[model samples]
Target: MAETMYDKIWNAHAIVERDDGQTLLYVPRHIVQEGSRFAFEFLQDRGLTVRRPRQMLASPQMSISTRRRDIEEITNPDQRLTVELLIENTRKFGVTHYGLDDPRQGIVHVVAPELGFVQPGTVLIIGDSHTCTAGAMGTLAIGVGATDVLHVLATQSIWQRKMRSLRITVDGILPEGVTAKDVILTIVGRIGANGGKGHVFEYAGSAIRAMSVEERLTVCNMSIEAGARSGMIAPDDTTFDYLAGRQFAPRGASWDRALRYWRSLPSDEAARFDREIHIDAATLAPMVTWGTSPEDVVPVDGRIPDPRAEPDAERRAHMEKTLGYMGLAPGTPVTDIAVDQVFIGSCTNARIEDLRAASAMIRGRRAVVPAFVVPGSTQVKHMAEAEGLDVIFRKAGFGWGEASCSMCVGMNGDTVGAGKRCVATISRSAAGRQGRGSRTHLVSPAAAAAAALTGRITDIRKMGA
Candidate 1:
C-alpha cells in the first residue's frame, strides 16, 4: 500500500501490533521538561528504574540521590514542593551534555531540532503537548502525559493507536502581512479545534514550499491546538540548509549522506492520505483569536461572531460564554479591542526570524502598550542583540527577557496580570493560561507589533508593506 509520510514514520517505529489494535512504538528521542519530575518518582515508586538513566539524567549518581531526597522532602515543603523536587529531579535525569543556559536549554521543542536531537525519520516523544513542534524536522513527535512519560521512561517505548493521515496543502502566494501563523490560524478557524483529531497533518504545496524552516516550525508547533497528534513539512533544501553546520548536525562527509536520507523522507507523489484539505494562501489575512479557543478566530478586520444566530443550543451557549469572558459583543470589530499587554515569544513563534519580523515592525515606533519580547533560546536572545533587534525592541518600549518558555505556559515568573488584556503570539489562550483571569487575544508577530503600537487589535497591513 502506498503510504503517507505519517505512515512511513509510524511503521518504521512500530515494534509490535496487538490484537486489540494498539501498537508498541519505539521512541528514538525523549525530550522532557521540569514537569516530568512526577514521572521519575512514579518509576522509582514502582521499583522500575529508567532503563538508561545516564541517557536521561545529567549525572547518574546525583540523580539517584536527588530522587531519594526529593521524595522525602515533598512532605515538608508544600509551597515549593514541585519546584525543589523538579530542580533536583532534572539534576539526576537531565542531559549533562547541554547546559541549561545554553541557547539549546530553552523549550524542549525549540532546542531539540536546533541541537539535532530531532532528525528526519525519527519517532520522538515528550511529556509536553507541544512536542509536535519537533515534527518540523520531518520527524514523528507527539506529546504524552505523565503516566505515558513513566511508561516511556521505564521501557523507552509507548503503546499508541495508529492515527490516520490528513494532507493539508496551501498553494499560491501569501498576501502581505499574512504569515505562517495566519495560515495555521485560518485553518483552525475553518476546521475547528477538533477537526484534525486522530490524524497526523502533512503540510505541503507552494505556500509551504516557500516558507523558511523557522516558519514551517511555527506552523507545525500549533498542530496540537487543532487536535492533531503531530504535523510535518517534508525535508527540502530549506530544511537541509538550516541543519547544515549546526552544532549537532552531521559534519563533513557525513553531511552529504544525511542530506540524501532527509531528501528521501518525503511522501511519494502517489502516496495516499485518509483525507485532504486544500487552502489558498493568497486569500489568507492577518488573523487573530476573538474567543477562548483557537478556532474562535477571524481576520483582523472581521467581527465577533454572533452565537445567538446559531441553531445548536450547546454550541451557542459555549460561544456566548466565551464572548462574555473575552469582553466581546456580537458584531463588534476585533480591531477595535484594546490591549494592555503584548507578548512575542513562545516555542511556537520565538525564533530568530520571529524576532526579526517583530523588530522590523517596531523599529521606529514606540509601544502604546506594555510589550515584551522573549527569544525561544538564550542563544537566539544573544544573536538578536548582536543584530540590534533587542535594542530595537527596547527602544519601542518592549522588555527583552531570558529564554525558558517565558509567558508561554505561565511557567516561571512571567505572566499577564488579573483582568488585564494581552495581545500574544503564543499558542493557547485558555482561561488562566497566561495567568489567573487574564484575557488573551492571539495574533502573529506583525499583528502583535501593530497591537503594541495602537494599544488595540490592529491590522498589520495597515501599518505598512
Candidate 2:
C-alpha cells in the first residue's frame, strides 16, 4: 500500500495493536523539561525509578522549585538521587538509553534533531506540546501528560488511537517579509484554531519544499496551536543537508546510508489524505496576533476585530473579553499599536537562522523599545557569538541573553511587566503568559525588528532589504 510519511514512521514503531483500537508504539527517544520535575518526584515517591541512572543524572541541572501547601519542594532533587533512582528503576523494568546534555538538552524537540535522536522512521514522545517540532524530521512525535510519561518511562511504550490525516499544501514563492511563521499563522486564521483537531497534518507543496529544516521546524512547532495532533514535512535533500555534519549526525558511509533511507520516507504522489487544505504562499503577509489566541491574528496592516460586529453572541463575548485584556479598541489599526518590549526568542524562533534574520534588520537601528534576543540552545548561543552576531545585536540596542527557554514562557525571571505589552516572536499569548497581567502580541522576526525600531507594530516590508 502507498503510505504517507506518518504511516511509514508510525508503522516502523508500532509494537502491537490492542483490541481496544489503541496501538502500542515504541518510543525511540523521550524528552522532558523543568516542568517534568513533578513527574520525577512522583516516580521517586512511588518507588518507580528510571533506567540508566548515570545517563539520566547527566542531564543539566534545572533551577526550578514548586510550592506545595506553602512548602517549597525542589523537583530535581540532588544528582545522586536522580542517578540512583533512574538506575534502580531502569534495572527493575527496562528502558532505552538515557541521554544527558548529549547536545540534545535544550528544548526536547529542538535538541532531538540537532542531536540526531529523531530520525526519519521513529516514534518520539515528550512531555511538551511543542514535541510536534520533531515532526519536521519526518518522525511521529507527540506530547503526553505526566501520567503517560510515567507509563512510557516504566514500559518504554504508550498507546495511541489512529489519527486521520490532513494534507496542507501551500505553493508559490513567498513575498518579501513573509515567512514560515506567517504561513502557519495564515493557516490557523483560515482554518480557525480548532480546524485540525483529531488530525495529523502533512505539509506539502512548493512553499514547503522550499523551506529549510529550521523553518519547517518552526511551522510544525506551532501545529498544536492549530489543534493538530502533529505535523510533518516529507524528508528530502534539504532535511538531510541540515542533518549532515551536525554534532550527532552520522558521518562517512553512515551519512550516505542515512540519506538514502531519508529519501525513501516521502509519501507517494498517489497517496491519499483524509482531508486537504490548499493555500497560496504569495498571499500570506507579515502576520501578528491581535488577541489572546493564535487564531486572533491578522496581516500587519490590518485592524483589530470589533466584537460588536460579530453576529454570534458567544463569539462576540469571547472577542470582547480578549479586546479588554489586550487593551485594543475595536477597529484600532494593528499597525498603530505601540509596544514596550520586543522579544526575539523561543523554541519557535530562537534558532541561528532566526537570530541572523533579526540581526540583519536591526543593524544600524536603535531600538525604541527594550529589545532582546535569545538563542534556543547553548551551542546556538556560542555559534552566534563566534560569528559576531551577538556584537551586531548589542550594537543595534538589543540585549544578548543566555540560551534557555527565556522569554518564550515568561519563566526563568525574564518577563514583561504588569500592563506592559510586547511584540514577541514566541508562541502563545494567553493572559499572564509573559507575566502576570502582561500582554503579548505574537509576530515574526522581521515584524519584531520593525516594532523594535518604531516602538509600534510596523510593516516589515517598509524596512527594505
Candidate 3:
C-alpha cells in the first residue's frame, strides 16, 4: 500500500490501535525542560518512576537568563525554584541531564539536534510547543503537557489519533534575500493559523531541499504556531552530513545501519497526502509579521492589512484587535514602524548559520536601537565566536548573549520593556510575550538585522547586497 512519509513514521512507531481510536505511539525520546517539572512533581506525588530513564533528555533552559553577567545569578524566587526542581527531578529520576555549567546544555530542542539525538524516522516528544524544531531532522516530534509527560516518562509511550497529512512544496530557487524563515511566514499567511489543524506538514520541493539543516530547523520550529501537529522535511545528504559527527549520533556499525534506514524514510513516489499546497519560490519576498499571530504576516515591503476589507467578520475583528494592539493603522507601510529593539536569537533563529547571516548584514553598520544576539546552544555560541561572528555583532552595537531562550518569550530577566516595539527572530509575537505592552515583530534574522540597522521595520531586500 502507498503511504505518505507521515504514515511510514507513524506505523513504524505505533504499538497498537486502542478502543478509543487513538494509537499507542512508542516514544523514542522524551525531551524534558524546566516547565515539565510539574510532571516530575506529579510522579513524586503518585510514587511513580520513569520506566525509560535513558530515553528522557532533560534541559533547564526555560527559566535561565542568557543575558546575566553572572551565570550563577538566580534572584527570582519562582525562576530559581523552577531550575532547582528540574535539577532535583532529573537527579531523582536518573534521567540524563545537561546542567547550567555543562558545555552541552542548551534549549531542549536546540541541544537535541545539535547533539544528533534527532535523526530521521525518530518519534520524540518534549514538554514545549516548539519541540517541532527537532522535526527538521525528519523526526515525528510533538509537544505534550504535564499529563502526557508523565505518561511518556512512566511508560515510554503516549496515545495519539491519526493526523491528516499536508504536503507543501516550494519549488524553484529562493532569491538571495528570501529565506526559509520568510518562506514559512509566507506559508502561514497564505494558509491562515488554523489551516493545518489535525494535520502534519511534509515540507518538500527545491527551495526546502536546498536549505541547510539549520534553516530547515527554523522552518519546522514554528509549525506549531500555524496549527500543525508538526512539520518535517525529508532527510537527504544534507541532513546526514550535519549529523555525522555529533555527540549522540550512532557510532561505528550502528551509524551505517541508521544511515541506511534514514535514506529510506523520504516519501515514495506512490505516497500521497490528504492535501498539497504548491508555492513558487522565485517570487517570494522577505516576510514580517505585522500583528500578534504568525499568520498575521506580510511581505516586508507590504502595508498593514485593512480589517474593513476582510470578508469574514470574525477575522476582521481579530485583525482589528491585533492591529490596534500593535498601534498600526490600515494601509500603513510596514517600513514606517520604528522599533525600539532588535532581537536576533531564539530556538527559531539562533543557530550558527543564522548568526552568520545576520552578522554579514550587520558588520559595517551600527544599530540605532539596542540589539541582542543570543546563540541557541553552547555549541552554536562557540562556533559563532570561533568564526568572529560575535566580534562582528559587537562591533555593530549588538550585545552578545549566552545560549538561552533570551528575549524570545520574556521568561527570564531578559525582556523588552513595556511600550517598546521589537523586531525579533523569535517564533511568537503575541502581547506580553516579550513584556507587557511590548509589541513584537516576528521576522527573519536578516529582517531583524535590517531593523537594527535602520531602527525601523526595513525590508532586507532593500538593504542591498
Candidate 4:
C-alpha cells in the first residue's frame, strides 16, 4: 500500500489508537515561548514537572525586542518581567532555554529550524500559530492551545484526531518578479480564509519543488492564514542540504541514519488526497492584501473589489466591512494607495534570501517613508552583515533592526502606528496584526522595498526587480 507523506509521518508518530478514533501522538520536540507561561503555571499548580526537558525548547520570543542589542535595552517593564518569568520557569523545569542574550534566540519557528532542532519525520508543536513554518523541513508541526501545552509538558505527547489531506500543485515557472510570498497570498485569496479548514495542505508540483528550502518555509508558514491545520513540503535533497551542517542536526553516523529515514518519507506516487488545487505559477503576479484578512488580496496592479457586486450576501457584507476599515473604495487601484511605513521582517520573509532581494532594490535608493528592516534571527543578522547587506540598507535610510518578530506581531514596541498604512512582508494582514488600527498590505520583500522607495504600493516588476 502506497502511503501519503502525511500518513507515513502521522502513523509513525501515533503510539496508540484511542477507542474514540483519536491517536496518542508521541511529540518528539516541543517549542515553548513567553506565551507558555500560563502552561507552565498550569503544570506548576498541579505539582507536575516536564516529562522530557531536553526534548522541549523554550524561548521568550514574545517579549524580546528587535530594537535592543542587550536585555537592559528592553525598556518596557512588563515585557521585561514576562521575559524573566519565561526564563525562570524554563530554568525551574530544566527545559533547554534560549534567552534574549542567546545567540540562537529568535522567533520559536525561525530559531528551531535554523539551529536544526526541527527535522524531517518529527512531530513538533508550539503555542504560536506559525509553528507550521517548521513544516518546511518535512516535520508534522502543529499549533496548540495552552492546555495542550500543559499536556505535552507532562507527557511529551498529544492525543489528536486524524486530519484530512489537501494537495496544492503549482505548475509552470514563476515569472521574474513573482515570489513565494505572492504565490501564498494568491492561494489564500483563491481559497478564502476558511477554504482549507480541517485539512493539512501538501504543497507540491514543479514550482514548489523548484523553490529553495527557505522559500518553502515562507509558503508553509502562511498555511495557517489559509485556515489549514498545517502545511508541508516533502523532504528532498534540498531539505537534507539545508539541514546538513546545522548545530542541532544529527552529526556523523547519526547523520547517515537520519538521512536514510528522511529519504523514505516522501509521499508515494500512488498516494491519494481528499482534495487537490492546481495553480499556474506563471500567471501569478506580486500580490497585496486589500482588506483585513489575507484572503482579501489581489495583484498589485489589480483594483479593490466592490462588495455590492458580490452575489453572496455574507461575503458581500464582509468585503464591505473590511473595505470600510481599510478606507478603500470599490474599484480603487491598489497601486494608487500610498504607504506610511514598510516592514521587511517576519518569520515569513526575513530570511537572508529575502534581505538580499530587498537589497537589490534598495542599494542606491533612499526610502521615501519609514522602513523597518529586521532580520529573522541573530544568525541571519550576522550573515547579512558579513555580506554587507546592512550597509546598503542603512545607507538607503532604512532602520536595520536586530533579530526577532519585530513589527510583524506588533509586540515588543515595534508597531505600525494607529491608522497608519504599511506595506509589509509579514504572514498576516489581519486588523491589529501589525498594531491597533494599522492597515497592512502584505507583499514580498522586493515589493516592500519598492513601496518604501516610492512611498506607494508599487509593483516590483515595474521597478525592474
Candidate 5:
C-alpha cells in the first residue's frame, strides 16, 4: 500500500490502539516553555518525574522581557516568576534547558529547528501552536494542552486520535515581492480560519519546493491559524542542506543512515490524501489582514470590505463588528491605513532571511513610525550583527532588540499601546493578540518594513522591494 509521509511517521511511532480508538504513540521529542509551568506542577502533584529527560527540551519563552535578562528587572512579577519557575522545574527534572543567558535561548519553536533538535521522521510535541514550524524538516509536530504536556512529561508516549491528511499544493513562480508570509496569509484567507479542522496539512509543489527551509518554516508556523492540527513538508535536498551542519543533527555514518531513512519518508507516487487543494502561486500578492481574523485578508492594494454587501446576515454582523473593533470603514484602502508602530519578529518570520528582506527595504529610508526589530534567537541576533543587518536597521531609525518572543505574544512588556495601530510580521492578528485594545495589520517582514518607512500599509512593490 502507498503511504503518505504522515502515515509513515505515524505508523513508525504508533504503539497500540485501544478499542475506544485512542492510539498510544511514542513521541521522540518534546519542548516545553515558560507557559508549561502548570504541567510541571501537575507532574509533581502526581509524584512523578520525567520519563525521558534527555528527549525533552525546555525554555522560558512566553513571558521573558526582551529588554533585559535580569529577573529583578523583568518588572512584571508574573513574567519574572514564569522564567524562574521553568528554571527550577527543568533543573529538578534534569531536563536540558536553555535559559535567557544561553545563546540557544529563543522562541522554543525557532530554537529547536535552528539547532537541529527537530529532524525528519521524528514526532515532536510542544506546548505552543507554532511547534508545527519544525515540520519544515519533515517531522510530525503537534501542539498539546496542559494535560497532554503532563502526560508527555510523565511518559514519553501520548494518546492521540488520527488526523486526516490534507495536501495543499502550490505551483508556479511567486512574484518578486511575494513572500512565504504572504503565501500563508493568502492560504488562510482562501480556506477560511476553520478550513483544515481535524486534518494535518502537507504543503508541496513547485512554490513550496522553491522556498528555503526558513521560508517553509514560516509557512508551516501558521497551520494552527488555518485550524489544522499540524502541517508538514517532505524532506528533500533543501531540508538536508539546512540540517547538514546544525548543532544536533546526525553526523558521519549516522548522517548517512539518517539520510537513507529520510529519503524514503516522502509520500509515494500513488499515495492518496483525504483532501487536496491546489494554488497558483503567480496569483498571490503580498497580503495583510484587514480585521481581527486571519481570514480577514486582502492584497496590498485592496480595500476594506463592506459588511453591507455580505449576503449572510450572521457573517455580515460579524464583519461589521470586526471592522468596528479595528477602526476601519468600508471602502477604505488598506494601503492608506496609517500605523503607529511596526514589529518585525516572531517565530513565523524572524529568521536571518526575513531580517535581510526587511533590512533591504528600509536600508536607506527612515522609519516614520516607531519600528522595532527583534531577532528570533540569540544566534540569529549574532548572525545579523555579523552581516551588519542590525546596523542597517538602527541607522534607518528602527530599534534593534534582543531575541525573545517580544511583541508577538505581548506578555513581555513589548506591546502595541492600547488602541494603537501596528504593522506586525507575526502569525495572527486577533483582537488583543499584541496588547489590550490594539489593532494589528499582519504582513510579511518586507511589507512591515515598507509600512514603517511610510507610516502606512504601503505596497512593498511600490517601495522597490
Candidate 6:
C-alpha cells in the first residue's frame, strides 16, 4: 500500500484506535521546559510518577533571563519559581535537566535536535507549540497542553485524532537573498492562517531538499502559525549527516540500522496527499509581515495592501483594523517603514546559520536602531563567538545576548517599548507578542539585520550585491 511519511509514522506509533476516532499513540521521547511545572505538580498531587524517565529531557528557556544565565538574575518571582520547580521536578522524576547555566541548555526545541534526541521515524512531544521544529528531522513531533503533558508523563502515550496530510512542494532554485524564512512566510501569506488547520504539512521538492537541516528547522518551527497540527520533511542524507555523531543519536551499528529505516520513511511515489500546493522558489523574494498576523506578509518591496481592495467585506474590515493596530496606512511602502528596534533570535531563525547570515549582513555597518542578537542555544552562542560572529554584532553596535527565549516572548525582561515598531525574526508579529502595545514586523534574520543598519525595513537584496 502506498503511504505518506505521516501515515507510516502514525501507524507505527499508534497502539490502538478508539471508537471516537482518536488513536492512542506511544510517545518515545518527550521534552519539558519551565512552563511544564503545572503538569509535574499535577502528577505529584496525584502521587503518580513519570512512566518513562529516561525518555524525557527537561530544560528552562521561556522564563530565564538572557541578560544573565544565573537563576538569581530572574527578577520576576513567578518566572523564577517555574525554573526552580522544573529543576526540582526533573531531579525528583529522574529526568535529565539542563539549567540556565548549563552549556547544553537552550530553547527545548533547539536543544533536543542539536543533542540528537530528535530522530527520524520517532514520535516526540513537548509542551510548546514550536515542538514541530523537531519534525525537520523527519520525526512526528506534536505540541500538547498541560493536561496532555500529564497524560504523556503518566502513561508515555497520548490520544490524538488523525490529521489530514498536505504536501507543499517548492521547486526551482531559491533566488539570492531568499531563505527558508522567506519561503515559509510566503506560504503563510498565500494560504490564509487557517488554510492548514487540522492537517500535517509535508514539505518536499528540489528547494526543500536543497535546504540545510538548520533551514528546514526554521521552516517547520512556524508550522503552528499556519494552523497546521505539525510540519515535517522526509529525512534524507542531509538529515542523517546533521544528526551523525551527535550526543544521543544512534551510533556505530545502530546508526547503520537506523539509516535503513529512515531511508524507507519517505512517501512512496504513488502516495496521494489530501491536498497539495506548489511554489516557485525562483520567484520568491524576502517577505515581511505588515499586520499583526503572519498571513499579512508581503514582499520586501511591496506596499501595504489597501483594505478597500479586499473583495470580502469581513476581511476588509479585519485588514483595516489590523492596519490600525500596526500603525500602517494603505499603500505604504514596506521598505520605507521605520522601525524602533530589531530582534534577531528565535527558535524559528536563531540557529548558527541564521546568526552567520545576519552577522554577514551587519558586519562593517553600525546599527542605526537599537538591535539585539540572541543565539538559539548556548552551543549556538559558543559557535558564533568562535566564528567571531559575536564580535561582528558588537562592533556593529548590536547587543549580543545569551541564549534564552529573549524578546521572542515578552515574559522575559527584553521587550520593545509600548507602540514601538520592531523588525524581528520570531515566528509571529501578533499584537502584544513582544510587549503590550508594541508593533512587530516579522522578517528573516538578514532582513532584520538590514533593518537594524538602516533604522527601517530595507530589502535585503538592495543591501548587498
Alpha-carbon lDDT of model 1: 0.80
- TM value for model 2: 0.89
lDDT of 3 by residue, 1-465 (tens): 888778889999999998888999998878888898888888878898999998878777768877663336767889878888888888988988887878788888889999997789989899888988888898999998899998888889999998999999999999879988999998988888888899999999999999999999999998888899799999999999999999889989999999989988998898889999999999999999988888999898889989999999999999999988888889999899989999999899998888888988875889999999999888889889899999999998999988889789777878988878999999899888998888999999988998999999988777875
lDDT per residue for candidate 2 within 211-259, as digits (tens), equals: 9998999899889889987899898888887777775677899988977
Better of 2 and 4 by TM-score: 4
**C-alpha root-mean-square deviation, each candidate:** 4.6, 4.6, 1.2, 1.1, 0.9, 0.8
Number of clashing pairs per prediction, in order: 5, 4, 0, 0, 0, 0
Error of 1 at 329 (Å): 1.3
Q: After TM-score superposition, what is the CA distance of residue 91 in candidate 5 from its true location, in Å? A: 0.8
Q: Show the lowest summed lDDT stretch of 10 residues, model 2.
A: 63-72
- The number of the candidate with the highest lDDT is 6
TM-score of 5: 0.99
Query: Once superposed on the true structure, which residue ranges of model 2 sit more than 4 Å away at CA?
Result: 51-105
lDDT of 4: 0.90
Q: Global CA lDDT of candidate 6, please?
A: 0.93
Write down the RMSD of candidate 3 (Cα, Å): 1.2
Instruction: Choose 3 or 5, whichever is better by TM-score.
Output: 5
Clashing pairs in 4: none
Better of 3 and 6 by lDDT: 6
Q: After superposition, how far is residue 253 of candidate 1 from its true place, in Å?
A: 3.7
Writing each residue's lDDT as its tens digit, candidate 6 over 1-465 gives 899999999999999999999999999999999999999999999999999999999988888888888889999999999999999999999999988768999988899889999899999999989999999999999998999999999999999999999999999999999999999999998878889999999999999999999999999998888999799999999999999999999998999999999999999999999999999999999999999889999999999999999999988998999999999999999988999999999899999999999998975889999999999999999999999999999999999988988999978789888899999999998989999989999999999999999999999888863
My TM-score estimates for the predictions, one after another, are 0.92, 0.89, 0.98, 0.98, 0.99, 0.99
Per-residue error at 402 for model 3, in Å? 1.3
Note the residue pairs that clash in candidate 3: none
For each candidate, the alpha-carbon lDDT, in order, equals 0.80, 0.77, 0.88, 0.90, 0.92, 0.93
